[model samples]
Target: MSKPLNIIFAGTPDFAAQHLQALINSHHNIVAVYCPPDKPAGRGKKLTACATKQLALANNLVVEQPVNFKATEDQETLANYNADVMVVVAYGLLLPEVILNAPKLGCINVHGSLLPKWRGAAPIQRSLEAGDGQTGVTIMQMDKGLDTGDMILKATCDITPSDTSASLYEKLAALGPEALIDTLSLMATGEHTAEKQDDSLANYAAKLDKAEAELDWSLSANVLDRKVRAYIPWPVAQFTFIDEKQNPQRIRIWQATPLQLAHGKAPGTILTADKKGIVVATGDGALSLTSLQIPGKKPLSVADILNARGHWFTPNTPITGQINE
Candidate 1:
């Protein structure tokens, strides 16, 4: 008969915390939890515990926070746990080969995307930005290369037209923990198979940057729409324009949609501004900015913003949406 495994769980963010919670509820024994060291956050700059660390403390699990595995003491501390397997989910620190091989079953990961499709730091956002029809969770056997691991299991979900990075994140969050628990169960019963990834099909998902959020008007409305959706809840899609005051003003786009119509105007020109939407000309089509946020104000609908600041988005004006950087 198969027995539950001793797991050493490593993770940091809220997504990781969700998986940890699942493991805590499972039959497996969690020997320890590993997360990065606390760091300053928020306007106050006070030290803050990551989601994983807070959950570990709440569950009274052993928590390890080594800066890195460079020190022999840290590696030895991990080795002493004698864990059967280590589960890693969005743990920021890179584990050295020695630490990776510490557990009896080595380490496995709960990656946000299907293996080889989107591999690296920002898989969730990159998948959405690429306009992928679907994306899913991959339970991968940890290897030395970056997300280049054998896949033990994959559970897919569609990326709807209305889905943003944040919404896709919620979907994967719901799918990932269940997949991780299932992988563990299969491993316990010796029923799991690991499949090698086709490197030729791999697409590296580079980390999100604030600079990438700049709305380049030259791009097609379809491309810009994807970017706007992908950048939400982080560096919200933004564009600059010379306001009526002649000063450069930056506005963040919260919600927008691509219109198939063309206005024959230069890219970034404001075609129309009304209660329906703020229609701006793009390289191929137009984009209707439905929700937006300006400096010192919360996000508001175009109708509400127009009621008070209609002059800010006057028609026939050109916005500085060119990607200079």
Candidate 2:
């Protein structure tokens, strides 16, 4: 048994929290934890603590949530920890030269996707959207540049056909801790050499938002289905329809499936809506709406939505709005 190394963990979100839990379970000398400050969330509009911050507070680890790490005051705060190493995961805020140089072993970043690919925000979603067959976590020695850090460990995970963002995220979240432990174990033995990422193969996973989440009916059913999966749990795919008073009722597409429909019908055209579901013709095929959320009502299954307000989306009805560019 070797002596535990002091670690300063920095991250945000549930994915980061998952890794922190594993570190605590392993009983490392966690000097302090760094995470983002609480932000307004939910219907109540109350300030909600970040996932990592909440976990740290519960575990009694010192928590730091600074506006910017580059500030002299913030750097002083981080240096006070006197940590042996720093671990970062989805920290959102960038690490500056002084802070990165503070820890004896430097900072290790547990990125969602393999380094040199999906190297920015929304990695998980972008991987699925791009139809990548596989993705994994990469533990790297952090640097000033984006995710350009040298790789300490690489672990792969398969992307299943039906794997949604939510499901795959859960799988990857578990993998991060195991990989982190292995990297740290090797580091302890002084046998680990961080490998440089291939810059030529790099790709950026641009941030996603409600604007990109809007459905483009002109796209094929397959493409739309991917969007639905990629944007789940945030900024879901949506389409517009005319309501009773002719007001635009934007429906958030929660779940859908692709269908082989002979197309020639205008994209965004509703082909039918009986009991099966709303079969909407696309540019190349059709999509079956399994679940959807009307603008002001709760999310409803295709059957339920049709039962309550089927008149708005009748068969052969044309969907309003231009296919989102």
Candidate 3:
């Protein structure tokens, strides 16, 4: 085996930290760890370190938290690390050309999707929302573009119909670390080859926001089903409806299925509520919401929720936010 290469790791969040943990367990020498600066979080808005920063500190690694590389000192400090390669996973910051070239073997990335497919901030979530049959990880030679890098390794995974964003994220987390280690081994032996991505086949995955989670009942049931699954664990798909008490209420849908049975009820109408699920009318079909959550309460299955608040979801009630004309 070739000598272990000097590596610098840049990442944030739990997904990135998993890859960092893999490198720590390997033979490579991690010269430095770089992540974004701590930001205020929680109700108190107290500054909080990211997952990678916490992990790096626990391992007694040299940690650097730079807001950006525009400062000359920051750039010089990184270059002085003298690293053979830098592994970036969900780093969130755009690297300048100088920073990309500072390392001996250049910077490599553990992207969450197969290149030329879903590429950008929320690959895992976007793939689920698009209802793709399969998605995977791509270890690439990093460049200035947004995930438009030359691929060094590819690891594929199936996207089951029941898979949510959180589940898909876990799947990639498992595949990414192994792929990163393999890519580093090949790089150390000078056996890695780069494959250029076909620019025509790429799709951008824009960052997620709460606004998009508002369920538009006017859309098809299948489309709404995908959105509900993709938005799980963050800004869950929600809809507003007037409750039995005559007050507007927002309900978050955590799990749902598209029912093929046709219905004449207007979109957003509550078609039925039973042990199976809360069936709601949509523009093209019906959706059965299996798991749901009310603000200030834990998520509950449709049966459980109905047992507690059976009067709230009476059939023929119209959900708010859309006109039924």
Q: Which residue ranges in model 1 land beyond 4 Å of their true spot?
A: 320-325
lDDT of 1 by residue, 79-117 (tens): 999999999999999989998899998999999998898
- Candidate 1, backbone clash total: 0
TM-score of each: 0.97, 0.94, 0.96
Instruction: Flag clash pairs in model 2.
Output: none
Residue-level lDDT of model 2, residues 1-325, one tens digit each, is 4457899999998999999998899857898999887899999989999999999999999988898876898899888888889999889898888998998889999988987899998899999988888999999999999999999999999987677899889989989999998888887677889899999999999998779977888889888888888888788888777665767878898888889879678888888786677888888899888898987888888889888887777777775533334
Q: In model 2, where do residues sit more than 4 Å from their true spots?
A: 42-45, 321-325
lDDT at 270, model 1: 86
TM-score of decoy 3: 0.96
How many pairs of residues in model 2 come into backbone collision?
Answer: 0
lDDT by candidate, in order shown: 0.92, 0.87, 0.92
lDDT per residue as tens, model 3, 181-240: 999999999989999999999999999999999988889998999999999888899987
